[model samples]
Target: MDVSQRLSFFAALFKVHENPTTGMWLLYITIVLLSILVFKLGFAKKLPIIKSAVIYTFLILGCTVLTFLGVFLPVAEGLVVAALILIIYKIRLHQEKKEQAKAE
Candidate 1:
């Protein structure tokens, strides 16, 4: 099969067209959460503007590509879930560090 055919095949495989509304919402939520996370992380490191710019540029590029491929929503949902997990892990680590510091 040709490129278009291959792409469609994969998009169908991922069920991108199954629920457009849900997918759009997922993409929206993913973008919002990612922006917040990036901003917070960047500011925490004292490079808010530069860091958020760099990270968001890549993220938007990736999202655009996925949108074109018709799998943007599913991918965005996965990313959001992963980011939340990472945030939770980071918070736990920070708490543990604080406890250790207090004990010492």
Candidate 2:
């Protein structure tokens, strides 16, 4: 299918066209929240509030642009899913390392 058709397919999957702005906002929020979750669980325990705000703002903008361009729907979803899975795996590995240290 063409780009518009592919985008429409994803939009239909998520009912995005019913309320475009709301759909965009929801997608932005989802990306920000997932990114924060991954960062907190696998990388840093704390982020400066300003730094966090800036990062999320840029993320939302970037994702929104990509979404509007009709290129982000499928690929971004897959990337987010993969990132979440990686975050989970990293957390499990860290916990195992801690347990090993305790045993040792």
lDDT of 1: 0.57
Tens-place lDDT per residue, model 2, 3-104, is 345553445455566667776666556655665565555565467899878876776667666566443356446547767787789889999999999999
Minimum summed lDDT over a 10-residue window in model 1 is located at 1-10
Report the C-alpha lDDT of model 1 over 13-104, residue by residue, as the tens digit: 44445666665455544555664575454344555788758866776666555555444225444445667777887899999999999999
Candidate of highest lDDT:
2
RMSD of 1: 6.2
Candidate 2 versus the native: TM-score? Answer: 0.59
Model 1's TM-score against the true structure? 0.50
TM-score of each candidate structure, all chains considered together: 0.50, 0.59
